[model samples]
Target: MKQFTSIAALTGLISLANAHGFVTSPTARMPGDAMASACGQQVEVNQQSDNYGNIQGELQVASGQSDYSASECDIWLCKGYKFADNKDNVYSYTAGQTVDFTVDIRAPHTGVANVSVVETSSNSVIGSPLISWSVYASTATGVTANETDFSVTMPDDLGSKCSTAGDCVLQWYWYAESIDQTYESCVDFTLGGSGSSSGSGSGSSSSSSSSSSSSTAKAETTPAAVETTSAAVETTAAAAETTTAAPVETTPAAPVQYATTTFATQARQSAEPSVEVQTASAVETTGSSVVSTKPIPTDGTAQEKLNFVESILKYLAN
Candidate 1:
């Protein structure tokens, strides 16, 4: 356990060094996080914070940022995540009020940023984030930081829950587009008034900060052979059934067509030869299994015969 604790401490320090910047203004003040909190120290000008150090950016909720847990996150990079912390420790503000979260831009890497709200009640992402585009850096204002701002609105949907929990968490995530990295920071605060009629009418808004995360969330694949072939068999069978019966005597007969299946294709189909399907037993055993389908003939007795074959195939498929 001692070994694990040391390793975890080392890892947190490493992440802080790499991620590169944090909430400079409206300084993120977490009780367990900052040592100054022990002495009840309010922030003073010219005094540097004891929060995070430079670290990498480009974190996706699915990957980089720490998950919203029922447990408190005492570790450094967990976005000041805490649960059931003392209410006296939190800062207060109005719910549904738009607030600008200032970020200290340390690195020159071009990136996009977002500020969001996570409702403590559900531990879910509540609404639209205040996002900015290819936000570049600027000159420092007081020997403090090269400042850029992310305007965040405490969602009105939070309602009286602000007073209920007496605290809500604000998350700031910056994804470095060029660099495949992410940086995040969080703040805890309370609302002044009820959030009942404040946010956009929509219940919940999705996080659109990282397109990479969006693409990862949506994944599609080619359908399995069984799914494709089974549906095909049913469709071919149905199409065949609609054919009008044609007399063999008047039919211009054509040899039946067959497609040679490779070992892989055969393995995928896992079906028997067409001859097996001729029997009623085989038809009953396989529900509309595909045996090669013939091309639909354009005209004449051949067309009628083609239709007749279709009907037979459809019956076997069923």
Candidate 2:
């Protein structure tokens, strides 16, 4: 029993030496009964002794324990910290709110790190990371001011995804790739309010675009309607001109033909009356006496007719 106790103490010391970092501010989740039931009592006790230890060390302790259930523990996420144990420590935040973070680095190991909003149930990142560092806490370069002290702004887009206390967490993830060690600490948070101003801005843009499109449609339709009406008006005017031209052409033709026939008949009648008067007075002309005579029929040329009338006029004068 004494030998076993000695070995255990030495193993604990080794694990502590290997562990590098943990979140110091904002009261990160700690091991409790809920964690022990899922991760095995030994693994829970191991973390209770040194909560700053890495996930690799916890897995080492869990390997020999029959009670550890990997599926239930989900140690890869937040080092299997249970929300039930940290219920009282949950944070309430509004969208676009900024939160300050402080991490204590007991030992330096060059690594990559990020802080993100994570959904607790599915272990999925809610969105892009709030902040990240490609190189962090290098042994040679040492930890920097930005690495240990920083702030992350809550996302504007998470409307109700994190309204409940246990639904989500602000997770700090650090992986020392060279050493193959990973450490995680989670801060429980519940978002308040409907959403952020950015969401409202997007909606306003959509409405403006819709209004502009509608105006454009109306503007296009008006020109087409005017063009159609103009075309119809031009067609009607052309048809009216064509209809009026037909009556003018037909009416003039009939009047010209009738006038020509009437003028010829009057000329013939006048010539006959003069011929009759001259013939009737031809035998009685010497002694101032008058005699009636019938007009003779003649189909003479135009000059002959003129000569015949002139001869009669001279005889009547004598």
lDDT of 2 by residue, 1-318 (tens): 896476467547756776688987666788999999999977787787788899998888888779999999999889998987877666555566556788998888889999999998999998899999999888889999999998777787987898767888889999988688899999876666533322211111111222322222112121112222333223244432422111121333242121122123311112232221224334433332333344433787878767666656665586
The sequence of per-residue lDDT tens digits that candidate 1 reaches over residues 1-318 is 896456345545454445455675444443342422321222100012223432221121112223322133322233433333333334444444445556765555556666666565555555676454446332222223333554555555666555433245666666666665565666555544534333321111112112222222122111121232443323245423432222123456574333333223421333453331233233444443434344445565977867667666677556
Identify the candidate with maximal lDDT: 2
What lDDT, from 0 to 1, does candidate 1 have? 0.42
Per-model RMSD to reference: 22.2, 38.9
Backbone clashes in model 2: 2
lDDT score, residue 58, model 2?
87
Estimate the TM-score for candidate 1.
Answer: 0.39
Let me know the TM-score candidate 2 reaches against the reference structure: 0.59
Best by TM-score: 2
lDDT values of the candidates? 0.42, 0.69
Error of 1 at 268 (Å): 88
